[model samples]
Target: MMPTIVFGVLSVIIIGFALAMVLSKNLVHSAIFMAATFVGVAGIYLTLSAGFLAAVQILIYVGAISILMVFGVMLTRRGDISASNLFNKRIISGVVVSAALFIILGRLILTSEWFPSSFSVPESTVGPIADLMMNAYVIPFETAALILLAAMVGAIILAKGARRTR
Candidate 1:
């Protein structure tokens, strides 16, 4: 009963924040809402007994990605993050595409056969995951980190260049 209530609350939060992120005019506000959506996803991961994934969601999505988005918005010299016009000429085509996607996804979800797992939840997953990351996946992990670092550096350079041009 308690878990159900928690799940319902988290679901509501996730959906609400996602909608807020999409509908918000201010880019900074959208980024903040996206962070909130990420937090709600972390909570969902926790409810599913995937603590490591929850931590990763919070750390990567909320901590790093959302902060990057906010910084990008801040560094821009635009008068306001808000769109001048909410609905453009392409709005009709966009809505049609979105509706088509929704119908396709809904059909897939309803038709999919989900398996019921018989195995119990593991006691600890962090240690084994850490070992795998350090041993087998170290190279790929480091490469990903370097890529993110390079992207950040590139963004900084571009911002500086824009300022110089101004």
Candidate 2:
């Protein structure tokens, strides 16, 4: 009973945040909403008993990726918030393509065969994943983190260097 309620709440959060992210005009607000959506997804993963995936979602998406997006938006933003997210000339074409894809997906789903799914995912996935990350893959993980940090630093430097002269 409680799990169901929790799942419902997480689902609502995810949907709301995703909508806010997409519709937000302010880039920073959109990035923050995206981060919130990622957090909501982590909560859903928790409800599914995938603790490791939930943690990774929080760390990678919410923490690292969202921060990167927020920084990129902030650094590159030139005009006022109201001027952001304007409809492009391709809006009509984009809408038409999106509607066509949606209709195709709807038809595929409605016509798909539903078999009673009996799939088994190994319960000990987290154990082996942790073992590999901590032991054999530690250096690679650290190297990746170092590369991300260097990339972020380089981005900041480049953005600052391109500042227009008055």
Candidate 3:
């Protein structure tokens, strides 16, 4: 009962903030709402016993993406944000497509019979998983960092280019 209540609250908060993000006229406010939505998702992860995923979600989404979006908005826009009619042409189409996908996935989930794992992972396995990620997956992790670095550098160069042209 407690779990259901917690999940229900988290779901409501997540959906509310997602709607707020979409409807917000102010870019900064939308970014804030996006962060709130991300945090709410992390809470949901926590409720599901995915502590590592929750930590990563908070670290990456709230720490990185939220800041990056705000910086992008600040860099690109001037003056108060206004509601956009950008979705006018394709809104119905998008909704139809998304609803179709949702229905298909819901059907798959409902029809599938999932079996529980036979073996339980020891608490001690967590440390080894972390170690493996830090060591074996270090290259991919560093590559991701490099990609972020490249993006930052590209943004800087583009900003400088724009300033010089002005």
Candidate 4:
């Protein structure tokens, strides 16, 4: 009952924010809407008892990616943050392709057997997963973090260089 209500609310939030993110003219506003969409996805994960996924959604998507995008928009001196032309001459073709793809995917989804007849939800916990990440996957995790750090530093340098020229 409560889960259903939560799911419905989060679904609405996710869809609304996703649409807003896509439709928003201002880049910053779009980033904010994207963050909201991430949060809504995290909420959905929580309702589904996927604690690790929820946390990752919040931390990685909302916290890191969204912040990086917002910073990128703010630091760059572009012509206009708000896009003037929302659609191009190829919009008709794009829409046709999108609709066809959607129909194909929808048909596949409706026909596929997602789970076995005797399938049961397995119990999950975050503790063992965290332990494994910190132990077995530590090197890979650290490497990824370093890569992100390098990208951020590069972005900062580019922004500073651009600022000096202007």
Model 2: how large is the Cα RMSD against the reference?
4.7
TM-score of each: 0.76, 0.63, 0.74, 0.69
The C-alpha RMSD in Å for every predicted model, in order, reads 3.1, 4.7, 3.1, 3.9
Q: CA lDDT, every prediction? A: 0.88, 0.86, 0.85, 0.85
TM-score between candidate 4 and the true structure: 0.69
Greater TM-score among 2 and 3 belongs to: 3
On TM-score, the candidate that comes out on top is 1
Kindly report which residue pairs in candidate 2 clash with one another.
none
lDDT of 1 by residue, 47-110 (tens): 9888998999999999999999888778753775577224456767887998999899989999
| Cα displacement (Å) at residue 118, model 4 | 8.6
Candidate 2 weakest ten by summed lDDT: 116-125
Total clashing residue pairs per candidate? 0, 0, 0, 0
User: Native-vs-model 1 lDDT?
Assistant: 0.88
Mind giving the per-residue lDDT tens digits that candidate 4 earns over 50-116? Answer: 7888999999999999999889778754677677325556767877998899899999999998874
Q: Rank by TM-score, descending? A: 1, 3, 4, 2
Candidate 3: deviation at residue 106, Å?
1.6
Q: Candidate 3: lDDT of 121?
A: 52
Which residue pairs in candidate 4 have backbone atoms (N, alpha carbon, C) closer than 3 angstroms, thus clashing?
none
Between prediction 1 and prediction 3, the one with superior lDDT is: 1
